[model samples]
Target chain A: MMPTEDIYQPLLNVIEFLGTFAFAISGIRHAAAKRFDWFGGFVCGVAVAIGGGTLRDIMLGVTPFWMTSSIYLICTFMAQMFVIVFARSLKSLDNTWFFFDTLGLALFTVAGLQKTLDCGHAFWVAIIMGTITGSAGGVIRDVLLNNVPVIFQKEIYAMASIIGGLAYWALVELGCDMTISVITAFLLIVAIRILAVKYHISLPVLRGEE
Target chain B: MMPTEDIYQPLLNVIEFLGTFAFAISGIRHAAAKRFDWFGGFVCGVAVAIGGGTLRDIMLGVTPFWMTSSIYLICTFMAQMFVIVFARSLKSLDNTWFFFDTLGLALFTVAGLQKTLDCGHAFWVAIIMGTITGSAGGVIRDVLLNNVPVIFQKEIYAMASIIGGLAYWALVELGCDMTISVITAFLLIVAIRILAVKYHISLPVLRGEE
Candidate 1:
């Protein structure tokens, strides 16, 4: 039974690495558009990939991951380098970048939910963490760039993460297989996000007077 | 005894408001430098004054203050308008701004430490929260302006908060009067920060590698 569980761990780790790479790439692309130097681009990529998780861990009183493992840092650096080397070619694939970004966002939400559950938190707390994990890196990225969060202004970003987390919770309550539940949650997030973007769905803004 | 405590509460509330005003002014001054619009300047001012404490409260599973009270928002807007009206004169009084910034940092740190202690956290946790409440606002400010945190790179800013926290903790452990301990801690932070800035005392950088 332990060996069976360990088998999936490697797969999860691979998915995590891929998600990090995709997220870092998105950050690098944004930094390039902002005309940042290589060092600035690298920092932005690393911060966007790890900022949310780092804040979560700090709040939970856990040691931050990047302080213990350099793999995340290395991956971000590679992502930045890749963008720098292939800037012109990558510029033509805006849609592809969006796809990767959405995929990474979904994976991050699932990862955050799983981590919070593993830490023995309640479902509501897990859902909140999932949304934070999915959206906070982007929030920090925008803040560091001196802009309002895109989620606060644009498509249904955090709403998708919330819906995915709820779906995960519902499936778990129904005693679905953990793997299937996780995959379903990821799909729900990606699908909702894609649909929202296509249809331009948005949350009602909190009016100043309200 | 109860009546006395209630009487003092009003005084404490006034002090808190004053501190918040000073902090908002510092933020507004910076926003003026950046030439942000009225709304942007107001948002920045409020964020700089309350951002760290809001984060601390959220992490501690408490309601954020500004969400509970509109006074902070109003104060920030007032600060922004005041700065806009007096931008030219204010720009000439750099020393006055620095002094108010130091005073605001000190008072905010004490307020944070007190809140954490009231929440029944450990001394170390209180110290950490105090430092977070004092310095994290400016970190957010710098990040929002697309710059590295001045505290992280420059003079002993965070160090002042930490030292003040330690002083508060030590005084409490020694059974000093709570009000006296709090006031002493605040004064210590202000003095240390001002002296550090005047003397150009700074932390050694971790140089050598990327």
Candidate 2:
């Protein structure tokens, strides 16, 4: 039997925590690759972990979720330590990284949708917010790392998030409750992401001036 | 000739408009230097003109200022056209750019301070918000341009904004009216910025990985 708050409020918190940790680890890795110092790495980690949700909350006229709790900050610091301790081994665990990144994306998308709806936003705005929650952190990370955002370079992950958001809406409209809709949407995003990676599927690249 | 709305709301709007135009032009000019296309240049222009205000409003729990009016967006477009038509000559006018940039920095600092106070935040928070409004757009622009932010490299302009905010507070506490305090603070920022540039003053560079 599902736990009380059976609407998955408890489940959402767990997903949010895991997503924060994964994104923080990913950010620290990028900062390390750029040869930033320890302090720089920690800054990057924190930015990636909280940037998306902070932006979403600001736009939603709500206080940033992280500001209400120190757990996200502590999680990022732990991620920084984990990178410092296992910098090389972390790279060798590409499959593990892949799984965590995929999981993070799925969790963030669902959580964003749920929060936006709870805040009384329309389904369209929720979809946009969901995509932003899933991918905007990476955009901020890319900015700090001095690269064009990956979403701009190619649309795979952002597109996946958008589709996941749409899937959630569709399921809801089809009479699935919040829990069923969330689970199905999360799985759909993971499947799309995995399939795209495995089959090398991507949108067309833009050609420059001839 | 003191005006009604004795709080200087009209003056704030004028400063805001001029600041937006200057920042937008600066953004477009940089984008052009990077060989960004017209669309890319416009995007950068909008980011620079409204970026800082957007961030500040978000942090302050208000809807972004730009969403309430299309004037800022239109102004950025005009700035883009201004750049396209005067691309080469614009470089020859460094003194003009300095004037506009300084004016923009000072104006944004005061506006941010005023808005923060209007939102009922503490003076210290207003000071921090002023600094952000004065300088964060350039950080965003630098990120888009793939360079480390100038603020990270040295703290001259941000320091000026901070000093300006403090000056406003001091003047108000000394019994000056709102208009007098605002004008004095704006001039103080401009003076500090000019002096810093003229004297080549900057914080010591951080030496790394020796």
Tens digits of lDDT, candidate 2, B1-210: 123275677776776677788899888888888999999899889888989888888898888888988999999988988899988788888787778878889988888898988887767678867887888888788888777655644447788998899999998889999888888999999999999899988754322221
Model 2 lDDT on a 0 to 1 scale: 0.81
lDDT for position A120 in model 1? 69
> If you assessed candidate 1 against the hidden native complex, which CAPRI class would it receive?
incorrect
Q: For each candidate, what is the lDDT? A: 0.76, 0.81
User: What does the lDDT read for residue A181 in candidate 2?
Assistant: 81
Worst 10 residues of 2 chain B by lDDT: B201-210
Collision count for each candidate, in order:
0, 0
Candidate 1, pairs of clashing residues: none
Error of 1 at A201 (Å): 1.3
Q: Considering only chain A, what is the TM-score of each predicted structure? A: 0.89, 0.91
- DockQ, computed on Cα atoms, for candidate 2: 0.13
List candidate 1 segments past 4 Å from native.
Answer: A1-14, B1-111, B115-210
Task: Give the per-residue lDDT digits (tens) of candidate 1, residues B30-63.
Answer: 5555544454455457768888887888767665
